[model samples]
Target: MAKDISVPFSYTKDGIYYFERRVPRDLQKHYSASKIAYSLRTRSSSVAASRATRAAQQLDEYWYHLRIKGSELPGKHLLRMQQNATKAPGSLLPSEHDDNATVSQSEAVAIYLRLKGQNRPVTFHRAAERACGYVIDVCGDKDLLGYSKADATRFRDAFIERKLTGSSITRIFGTVRSVVNLAASEVGVNITNPFTGVYYDRQSGVIERAPLPADVIKAVQRECMKIDDDLRWLVALISDTGLRLAEAAGLLREDLVVDADIPHVVVREHPWRRLKTCTSARVVPLTGMSL
Candidate 1:
């Protein structure tokens, strides 16, 4: 004996036939099977049945695609239904997934703004906006969340072809990856970040030290002598004491102390301005000169 197979079906009040498997569960709440069948019956019983059946199939396909893409159910079914009714023949409905399914370049920018509102830094948001814009410019009408590996690879190649600096390219790619990860979480979609495996070249670090030859030191000292005596003293204090320029500049008259037993300076806050560093406020021995 053969096993029995049961396929769901819907019927109109006027006795028109339609398939139930095609109708999405989300749509069934607002649009009853009988109502859809009756609406089709007004045209022609046979034609109505076919139309209802096709509509059901379309809904099924849309839901299937959303499932494959790992997207969540849209918040509003009636709005989605209206959009579906107006779509061109063979065109997918926008409500099959979230509004973020196939985002416009402008919409991508809006996503960045939302991230910024959550306390993301301005630089991160700006870079994400730019990367998404570039992706949209290259791949028109394609869902970024559902982009294939080939698409991601091609986009990486395109960026490289533009001859942008490696660091700049890396920053943009990093921003895109972060945005996509965040969007995926928000929409309940699981997508492979395009920038996951991409790497950028790093430039060598070079150190430039100031020259300190004896002849150069003599020339600098001669130049310092041409200035006022007070300025010359400041220069000498910095050179001998290894004090930072700001610390030397912050010294005050009261800070200069002269006692036979302990000849040292006592730096204090001057005119309500504190020293740049705690070390700058300490007393130091006056070995070579008197105050």
Candidate 2:
């Protein structure tokens, strides 16, 4: 018989439905609240189910952004929803606005940073600044809607004058254009995306770095076997796991699961470290010497 999994994340108390969920054990440290509970404020089972579903989904988003920002709520509505669950759950979305086009270049950069920089690497934030700074310098202080194709062409030419290669210029344009796009989509900024259809030379400054040879891997493994220290384990782990050096180095005992049917390593954010991206957060099954 199929098991009953109905209404998985809700319960009733005194005829009122309440939503609840436990924090994942690994992420417990990141949450000030271990178990989240809020009154869904409905008596009907159907209504409770719908509200609970939204509340549950929002809880996932809250947890996700919490992990992304290392304990900070990504937007005010997320906190508002948490604190006031009696309100409709789907109302937790970021406040909608139609004023993005009017936002100046400098202000747009600030908004972009506010959206992305909470837990990102310092270098990531700095890269955005450098990319946007070049544009602001070339285009002068202007609203995003006011930035013309001529300004974009000038920005491109300025990079050319600096002797920057096509690939580098492409990266800068991509970064700044992403900011414009994000503002347009999120803040209702009226824009045709001035940077669109603008092409540049992308042939130069491309470098190739290939994987190590099999013999080099074999030699490293042999050397790892000869030593019995953490460094040796680090070398062996990196060789076989195909994990980033920092990811492997940051693993705590709690992150390793050896006795499961499939042994795996959990890549997660910690107080001391943040995953490079959400896609970087994953479970890699143990294999070969990694097991």
Q: How many residue pairs clash in each candidate?
A: 1, 1
Q: Which stretches of candidate 2 lie over 4 Å from their true place?
A: 1-101, 161-167, 184-188
Residue range 1-291, candidate 1, lDDT tens digits: 111122124444434343334345554443424222212323245555455455566456546755586333321111122223433421322344565564433333444455443544445454555577556445432555666666666777776676666666676667666656665554455667765786545331324567578677566666666874877778766654556666666777767676548777666556545565456677776654223
| lDDT string, candidate 2, 1-291, tens digits | 111146658777777777677778766654556677665556677877776686667568757866776543422111211333343422322355533335556556656666666667878776776777667556764668888888888888877776788788888888898878875555554578887767677876566779899999988888888886899888787787898888988999878898999999898988787777779989888776666
Structural similarity to truth (TM-score) of each candidate: 0.36, 0.59
The candidate that achieves the highest TM-score relative to the unseen native structure: 2
